[model samples]
Target: MTAADDSTFLNISLPTGTPKAERVAFLRLCTALATASLDPADAIDRNLWFAEAGLGDLYNKPTLAAAANTLIDLVEQGWTLSTAYKHGPLLAPPPSNADPVVEKARVRRQEHLRRDPQLRKASVRRFVEGMEKPREFKGKLVTVFNLMRDGRELADSLTTAPDPGSVIRPYIQIVDGSRCERTGYLLHDIWRYFRHTWSNAYSTVPGRSMPILIRDAATPHHAVIGLAAISSPVVQIAERDEWIGWGTDTFLEEVRKAPSDEIAAWLAGRIDAQLGEIYLEDLLADNVLQPTDLHHPTNEAIAMLRADAERHRQKHHRTPLSEVRQIEQDPWVQRATSHLFRSKRAAMLADTLEASRTLRPFFSPKPAADGLCQALSDTKAKVQLRRLIRRARGERVGTVIADLTVCGAVAPYNALAAGKLVGALAVSPKVIAAYRAKYSRPSDIASSMAGRPIERESRLSFISTTSLYGSGSSQYNRLRWPAAVMGGPNDKWISFTELGRSRSFGTSHFTDETVDALVRLSRVKGAVVRVNSVFGEGVSPRLRKVRLGLAALGWPSSELLKHGRERIVYGIKLVENLRDYSLGIDPAPEYLLDPEQADETSVGVWWFERWGQRRAVQPAVLESMRRHRLVRPISHGARVPLPTDETDTTPTESMFFSADSS
Candidate 1:
């Protein structure tokens, strides 16, 4: 007490109860600062290291100025100095309440490298370094970049923190490109820095030297491993909002826009793939920070679980899920777990089925529920059938089939329709019976349809028997019809089911007419004729049923309704081999053929058939051809004869036949 009291009285040893470790750390930092104080050349590392120690709270006075002051103090204290000059005193003083000791340490450290020649040389060296030569891959970095951007936009358009996986899976193509991979590499570097700096505070091994989560040191391997280095471990453990909301579109766009190179393209693809994988994890997150219905059953189930968790949380602040389940019987949750493909049964069964040869990988694979898989298979079969019919009819399905099939993509129509049908079958016994009768084997049908008359005598029975409108409404849009009815592989095709209805239906009654039409059809028996309008302005109603003969079928007042008068145009040009001469004109094999050209409408039932087929094709050739055509028509052009330039020596064969056919 005597020594301490005397020291305190002399103000040499203030009232210091701070931990020994902290004091040691501070002294070490001071020593480092002192060592670099006189020389401005060593300041960057000196101050940067000090700041890294969590003294950012000090060295203010416009940072550089504070560093200059720190340098001056260290110099006065007779500390070793480097060959550099101090930058300057900070223009503004640090906060009045800031700790002077910390401030002094930071100021001193920062001043060490204020004018170091080596630092300048290092910076210049980096600028002068040459980058690796560019490479080429299957797809362009720009395209993938565009896809990411589009995917992000699509995801953000949804109400929830979109089903992260679905956000990228549908739009991003995993073709050969380095854009995504490079991005991953960049992310790796960034995280490496963070990890290295972080470890200094907590771990013995330097962060940079330590392996990332996956432990693979190989660059390509590291690039492929998505979870190796997330933004922050805390965010990951807490499931931070940023993690939930991590979309790489903006970052990817930059990658895409980078100079066209193989490395860039490949990296882009890798990054996209990684993003897609992360998205899937996010989709599987229990609590969807941004909830979206546009996700697969597994994702939806996860979101539902999250919602249930939130509900439980609201009810019993911070109660664990296990205990909360004991409090209430949750059927919605149970059913979701069972049918939504996240349940243990679904996972096991799906994995088995996927491994088996009986099921198609795209239509039926791991983690898919039996019912869902069957529905997906049926939808896929129907799509294949439609495509076959379309190809037979003459449609041009894009080359996205390989992508869609391998990735297990279901057309919006397929999802919507199958979902609608499945819902209906689950809820309506008649619909189930009808589907069984129509699709099941005869023996099975005979066993299942025992005793009941083949034909039922009610509208509900008929609809149930037909399996037209499924039981549950869509999760995305309740008022709108299921996408299945429209029958296309794209969202655009699905829109047909709604008759070009605007998305702003909830805002006005105009769309109510469309809903009314659907409702009328649902309620009315047999063929009913109802004239509906978009504006809800025209509604002519008449109650009448017409019978054609004594035992003839009958029709209700509703007409066989047609869609609105919107005409989509398609133009066709015909090319034919013109040859064989008889009498007069022996053309130089090619001539002006404008009159032989014809423009025709691309309408009718066969239009879809002509354009809805897919084939394995290289995109590079298609793109090149397109560009070539844009510059100059790939097909030959006709040469017109001019009276002035003609030598009047046109060859006229003795037995030339009529060659031009219009």
Candidate 2:
């Protein structure tokens, strides 16, 4: 093939939103056309091509027409054998009189292609092979793989030995959901394993979810350690709200009162119209003059009426109604009435009267008849009103805290104290900075402060239960940062009681039973298993199959896989920030580089000297630490030992480890 044909075939770019069947058909057709010796001038016969590819029965006329048009467009763009072979590939055709900039770009691309012939050739070969043998679709059904039985040899090889001399360093990196590269595959596999072996509950990766992979960077082959998924900050948390001075009662009260307050303000204005009508009615009722007489009253009669009204007003405490009556009796007033007050008074009188009647029940400060205050107070009316309020406010109702949703290490790494490494990275300034930037919009910041949907700023990070509590493993507490450094009162290194009080208020697809099953599975297996979704319920079978395939070898199957759902609501506060908190940090000072460098020994010594001398640590800090059994009293300048005995022997491990450990 000509260089142009090679380039065109090698870099096939398909339009998005095309159906799978049509895409496959198009690929097959392209491969057939490229391999066959056809004349460039001959128009492609759609019917013959479809028949040759065994797709004649599958596509309809409209679909075939669309496909034909797409093919024609591609050929026009030099993405076909005719254009590639007849003329050079459009990407780098023989120089025509073109713009200097465009020509320079083309020449540069050609140079790169020439310099990397092997890479280009490999790419072309892969594309041709892929087009020639497209993947066949089987009807969606998940067949459990017996990894233990079928892949015993492979399984044994993977688990047979641990490299004692080879240190396992896990690096955590965030995956961009928009790109479907190797990182995407890593995320998919992690979720799959969690579903089949850890949690039978199906989990979904949310649009705002930051999916992270933990990989062993020490080995030549970067094997995955585990998966950590962090979703958008929660809108409401009871404990978090309490901490921020907005508890459940306060949040609900504010929501309920806002609408009522609005209605009250409207009613207050409305009451004034009723009062005006009442004043007008009293004047009209007490008038002594007949309507005809008032319309054509002489000046003498007007003077007499005025005199009488003055006398009545002097005798009574209130103003006499005859004062207004006398004005209506004047000839000039009658004439002006015809010009200005003829229909205006009548309309005003009617409106005020109607308002007075409608507001009669509320005059005594009772519940408003049809206003928001009335609806909020009445239990029956509150449901709809509450929904309206929530919708109007966009469901933000509490304080926001950056939640550390999932944190742990896989088998080998977990055994090697990799949990602390992953945990520290989870709260690293870089990761936190990315999250903050993601939600930096004005709307997001507003929502987060209000405890609503958008979460832009977070001063705290928390976890629900320690790995020790759920998985019978001490990796979380031992390896992770002590609660003191995270900005909590020393007395409460970790709040065990708060775990039960944390609440998740949102809709989730998984039924309570499914969630319970997943939790139970995690407890039984001694692993932290989280459910994103279920199986056949609302989830697509194709997606379920792909996720299931990512399970670890020797995964056991269960029958409770009927429901397919993504997104679960679990509430707990496992991590927190007590002091000045920020997300990304410039590379930490060279000495404090690695995540492990922030270990208890280095941190404790630093705190004792740096913060202690300045009295930055609270008076109760040391006491609280001692109370929590987090530290042992020692003389100044004494060395702090590692948390575990296994770690104590590895003095070199502590010194050399850095964030650049990867």
Candidate 3:
């Protein structure tokens, strides 16, 4: 950490116009910081705090450079920022009123106030006071609201309790959002409310979702013992992608040596003839396209695109992105896009197209292992067969591969580690069947673009989720079922595979108000806010808007977006070959669970034997369950108390500050 020994990290070049005195002072400060043990986010915050107090000048390029150098050094030494930090100073303003981050926060507050003025708040308060009389919960003898039976009748079960594993029958029921039956959407929303309320990080995004209710038949009225849901998987996840081998894997390896006519016809059929031209027009005109938009274009295609995009930027001298319908109708662009694919990759792509045909364009900081070798490595041959494979990976991201939005047991069941049981059922046959039924309908976006309902076979092949708190989820650790029982290969197992942690990059930490203010500020700064709230515009529009705003404020969006905490990611495969089945290369998925014999019932039996019985035998589990008697405070394990005198929702200031937020 000393200057003599740590010169590599401490070596920094100040700005051209930086005074000699300031450079010397900054280097001295940098030397002190280099030895200090601090996280990247903490260092940035402390530096900014000092700068605001006239102790440092972090605004200037020279000071920022020094700080960055120090940060890079700390990062190399195994220091990191928590990605879950919400009020990070990196993206937001410092405490100083003059700071841009502070100003943006002020603007966000102002905008929120302006949108819903104090007058409106006062009016609503007055109206509420005048309209309704204050009421309290009274002993309800006539109007009873509960899913459980009479307390007296239930209380006896604890004293003369039967073996929970033998009597308690657990089963999974698919919750359809549209159904009006008793065991339908209402229960799902109720479960979601409890789920989000208890877990600070749990959230549901736009797009596809499937809510499943786990019920215990032994309990009165088939009461909800646990809840789980499946939602659309994100298009890009670095750790998940690398594990799936999106780049090293090949999509058309067998067809590589096929006849030119045969290959051409197959490629032509795979191409979206209707949406291809229109999408390509949007791709060239606008910013760098989302890789999911293209169908794994070849090395030649990507090169042509970068060249064309650069040309458009220079010629237009303004906005390049166009999602408008007008461009789709452009005759010349239409003609150009029609031949763009065939002339570039489709024509030249064959067995002969080897490592020599390298991609000149840069996708990331480090080049991928896309057919590169040392034998002919003298040239700058950067082949990008990754895109084609990546495209295959993305095909099922929206449909076939669903992420668990919420998966865990409720109170009494959780006492016996029933959460593990829920995790086990996540990959059961019933879930797969339910997913197929829910998403088999025509895609609205695809249907509209093609002028007809496009019915594609959308079935669940994989189920994935991230740990809620830390580096891994305890409920899923060593959780597996014998593949032979589930009708899979005997050598393999149907278990959750560790897919590495996420890179901890997102805009979740930024409050809605912060994002709104940033978007407003971006507009004032003459920055084109591309997130138009339009469907199919992009994933996580709020995040996109926030990134643009951060950039407008002269900050690196990529760096600031990384708040630092990364959660462990896990994936469960229902099909034999997840990559191939997901890419539509395999016509029918080789599901792990048998169609006729193996089902949710089998899963229930396994859960009882696998985890439930073993847990119930533990003295701690029995003692915990004993406390959940009829008269005991409800939902204690979930950190929830009902609308009663015991319910303490009001915080006493100690929660927010060292003393009080006073």
Candidate 4:
């Protein structure tokens, strides 16, 4: 056998107890005789077999001699050519009475059973019916529709246009949670339809969402055209924060400072008011203070003040002071008590001074007091306070954009371009005010008044939305809409891969099939090889050389590596990413429609195009790749090389590179 053939056999796992030298020699001899059209029984001459197998020089070697002696022993033991030459014992006894005709009939029967038309039709029908029916989703009754309905509604709405200023002009209204039982149900139905028909996967609408319903104003019943569900903004998004000129530092600082100020002010005010209402003279007059009392009148007054402070703390959810002097000279306290207790006519001036002295040390350091107050405050209250403060600071702190988690127009309305109107109304001051008002109530006045009032007019800065890539009906990307034309810079803000990784805050819909395909592909070839260098031997050098060769061969370096990790030690360049060299074109929807059908090359091309790489590799680096067996030569007219260990054999018309002459 040639070195290549020997290498191939050696790669296979050998059976246990098989002597390595004897097994190699036996396989080589059999392979050589088989290739030379000579029976193994006639090739017992070791020299002739060795020469044919291209191992003549090793004939006299100890390993070969042992193998020859083993073969002689096996022959003497009555082993025949057929039985002795076989690699392993039969896994199962040969089939009895084997018949090609019967086997063919059985295979045909299995194929027919697998392709049963009735079964296939029943399954498809069941799926379509399930998609058509209304079902409870996310704790609400939601209606569903298929893509056919989506396309039909869009066509009808486009052909019919309502007159401008007509009562039929579309308008968006906030769904009032308290009174929107019917509206909420309708919204869920619309969302279910959108999700079932348009979204790649289903996700429950987030809690505390404000559902906006778009309706035709001119229509007598205000026919619903679209639906949008807005939810709380993500706490942090690098792109959004950078765009709004708010860095991580500024955001953290403001969040920390605002709550601290509010807590401190509130505590100081409560303490001052409670202390002012109590007077030492009044306590003495009530006969609560006696001349012979063990506690001084001033001490009794301080005790009464402390008790009052505790009651105030419990009532307002403030932290009770472990020490009494914490709020003695608080600015808010001094301001509140100055006129009532520190006036020239005050009868208990000495006692009040003593009380202030007792309180000074406790409130001297605001940080300790702030920490105590924060710990004692209700968690919900603190969060609400922070949100209010963030709103009040406006664009300086960060832009408040409505996170449109679910935004899509209904059948006829969506077709007529009503989604843009909904998008516009989402950020409109009037709509925002209505949405705020619907949730606001007299009962919430106390809580609302606790935070500094935010100006609603300038609070909202923008609106953000996302859609699947290549989706033609994405409203966010539709340029003709007034909202799109009036909006700020429009670009692909985030990629699906990034969104998929961040489950907590990102909005991406990855179907089960896509995820499974990705996992399977990753297992086969997506995993990167770790190159741990021991005594300077590592795969990194080979990889680097391969990269250089590809670059020298006109392959783009930016497209060489893909985003994936293996064992967290090596960054793997996927075979899929190699499509950039094989097919230098962007991927089309048909190419990526089914991930299961996607091979490494097609996936790499799709990923490359999806990321929009513009950089190209320098020719100087191509030499390195050539030396590392990373790339192989192909035919003159072929863009992709034939099936080799280095390249995929799957033929494609979209090949990028011509076969290298060298």
Candidate 4 worst ten-residue window by lDDT: 563-572
Residues 1-662 of candidate 1 have per-residue lDDT tens digits of 01212211111110134344444444445445434434333323334655654444332212222223233333332323322223211111112224545443433342222212222343322321211111233442111111011111222322243332221111111121222343332333323222221101111121111122211112212211111110101101111111211113322233234423432222223222222212222224544323332222244444454554444324342334354334223332332232121222222222222222222332223223332224233644333323222221111011000000000111111211222222211212222223323322222111111211122111110110111111211321221222222221123221111212211101011122222333333233223222221111111221111111100111111211111111111111011111101000121222112221121111111211221111102233223222211011111111111112233333233212211111
Candidate 1: lDDT over CA atoms? Answer: 0.23
Per-model CA lDDT versus the true structure: 0.23, 0.35, 0.50, 0.33
User: Residue 55: error of model 1 in Å?
Assistant: 30
**Candidate 3 overall Cα lDDT vs. reference?**
0.50
Is 2 or 4 the stronger prediction by lDDT?
2
Q: Rank the candidates by TM-score, best first.
A: 3, 2, 4, 1
Rank candidates by lDDT, best first. Answer: 3, 2, 4, 1
- Segments in model 1 whose C-alpha atoms lie over 4 Å from true places: 1-135, 138-208, 211-662
Give per-residue CA lDDT, model 3, range 184-303, as digits (tens). 335544454345323333345777888877876765346556778888887777666656544333333433423234323322223333234123334435533444425444555545
Best-matching candidate per TM-score? 3
TM-score of each: 0.15, 0.30, 0.61, 0.30
Per-candidate alpha-carbon RMSD to the true structure: 34.2, 28.5, 12.3, 27.3
lDDT of 2: 0.35
TM-score of 2: 0.30
